[model samples]
Target chain A: MLLKLLIFPGFLFLFLCALFFDWVDRRMLARFQGRVGPPWYQPVADLIKLLAKEDILPTGVNPLTAAVLPMVSLAAVLTAGLYIPFGAFSTASFEGDLIVVLFLLSIPALAYFLAGWISTGVYSVLGGSRALLQYFSYEVPFLMALAGPAILAGSWSITHIVDYQSQTIWIALMQPLGFVLAIIGLIGKLKRDPLDIPKAKSEVVAGSLTEFSGRKLALWHLTMNMQTVVGIFLLVNLFMGQSSVFGPIPAFLSFGLKSVGILLLLSTASALYARLRIDQLATLGWRVLAPLALVQILVATWIGG
Target chain B: MASPLRSLAYLLPQLWRALKEGPHTVKYPFDPVELPAGYRGRVIIRAENCRGCSMCVRDCPAFALELEREGRDAYRLIYHPERCAYCGQCELSCNFDAISLSNEFVPGKPDRKDLGVVLVNKEG
Candidate 1:
């Protein structure tokens, strides 16, 4: 159990996957923009460099909150990682654990909000408010989108969802609207551009991250990347069918390829679109995505029954 | 709303083409760059043809050039890269054709001493 948690399908595995996935996203985005991206080791290099830098605490900021929030976020993501099945194995999972995973997934954003709120900078405050606003905007539809698969599989367990998909067809095909909505929600959840209003560089200077530097910032970045991996893992399992279609090796390959494909699609979207305004984001997430998610749930229910 | 959908349709094909084309960035440092014609870079001095003329020193907007007398009509031409704007004014001001710009754009040194170029006129 210790080995499983420390290594495969847990902290180390998920951490590496997060870094690699981030590299893939960056590389694909660079290719889309007709530029050579950083080398494969760039993420590792960035982490090391950030670690080597001096941690600067801004005035009026609670040092404990500033230092601890990133670790809390990282812990949330790593804990969520244990619930997400990798290839054919999950480090930790139980019946109705999907709800737990869903809750865990939001903790990082909450951490960001707290980190921002505890900071003295006006930009951090603005970023914190925006983060809260973004949380409200996307969380509902994201859960609703997840509901499509949960309903279709008749189980709230991720393993069962994958099992159901492997026996029949991927949920993505069965609930196409839900899949699309889920992907959109995933983009917003990950804070990618077009949905990255909180940390809009031009406006808020990294939003909630404006005050963090050195190791704290590195941990925060790692948390964000791990969230990306977790998000992609959830999407793949819920929609791309079970990874163990053939065997362990084939499962790993297919899972990797599908993850890359999804990452590329995300990178493409991020590259193509500009950042949405806070108002536009709210409208899109609530006015558009919420209704779409509802319709998908209705359709999924009818078809599932 | 429809416009965004329309633009997405337009964007998909372009994105596909871009992906197929692969990355457009040049592998700089590892691979040599093909600098465009008339590209102005670091200035080089031709000490043999130089007559210790200070026109370059006077005309330099960045004050990057200095001519120190080493002997009678002999001078040491010092180029300080820290101050150089790479505007090629020094290269243009040399009537003796003593200085010209090279296409090497990599400012590779961290130390200012490594960046400074000194040329001494031997037959002044």
Candidate 2:
């Protein structure tokens, strides 16, 4: 059990996957833009470089909170990964694990906001505020969109949802709108392009992370990268269904391939769109996506009944 | 036209083409770059062909060249690459076809003073 938690399907696995996925995301995005991307070991090299650098704290800042926020964020994301089933192996899967997973996934954003707000820099404060505002904007539609899968499956367990998908049809085929909304919400949650307003470099100078350096920044980066892996895994289980698409293929291998497909799709979307303004994102999220997600849930209910 | 979905439909094919074509950037330092004809680079001077008329020195816009006459037929041309604008005025002004710009570019050196090259030294 300790090996399961610490090695396979746990912290070590999630950390390695995070680094690999970050590299893949960058490579795909670079290819889309007609450029050569970083090498496979670039993420590992970057993390090590950041770790070896000097840690600097701003004047009048709480050093403990500044240090701990990124740790807490990374811990939350890692813990969330444990609940997510990776290739039919979840370290901790239980009833209502869906809700627990969602809540855990959200802590990083909150930690990010606090990281910005706690900093003495103007850019950090502004970035934190923007992150908070964007969080509220996307979180609603995201929750509502994910809810369609749970409601349609008639169980809150992600394993149950995956089981439901294998027996019936993929939820994505059943409710394409929800699938799209969930993807969009995942983009917002991950803060990719078209939704990366919080840390838009032109206006905010690395946004909430303006003041972060050394080990703290590395942890934050790890947290974000791991969050992407966790988010893609969740989407794969929720909408892409089980490993049935690759018949006779190992469950883990299919799960990995499907996750890469989602990563490529995410990278393509990131490459294709320009960043939206905060006001524009809020308007789209509430006025457009929220209603669309509600209609998706209604459609799912109609089909399920 | 204003819709993202419509825009995406148009952008995807272009992205596909770009991916197929590969990156436009060269490896640079690792690979030799092919320069074009008539590309102005470092100035070269032929000591044997020089008439010591000082036309090249007089017409130099950047004052990057100095012609010091040692005798009636002998002259030395000192070229300062740091001040050279690569305008090719000196090359054009040379009536004896003694000075011209070579196609070979000068690579950067750690010491700026070493950039100066004495292109001509002829003794009477």
Question: Per-model i-RMS in Å?
Answer: 1.3, 1.1
lDDT of 2 by residue, A23-81 (tens): 99999888888898888999999999999999999897899999999999899998889
Specify the poorest-scoring 10-residue window by lDDT in model 1 chain A: A241-250
Regions of model 2 farther than 4 Å from truth: A243-249, B1-5, B51-63, B66-76
For model 1, how does the per-residue alpha-carbon lDDT over A173-226 read when each residue is reduced to its tens digit?
Answer: 888888888888888888887789889999999998888889999999999999
Q: Cα RMSD to native, each candidate? A: 2.7, 2.5
Query: Which stretches of model 1 miss by more than 4 angstroms?
Result: A243-245, B1-4, B34-37, B44-49, B67-79, B90-99, B102-108, B113-124
TM per model? 0.90, 0.91
Question: What is the fnat of model 1 with respect to the true interface contacts?
Answer: 0.70
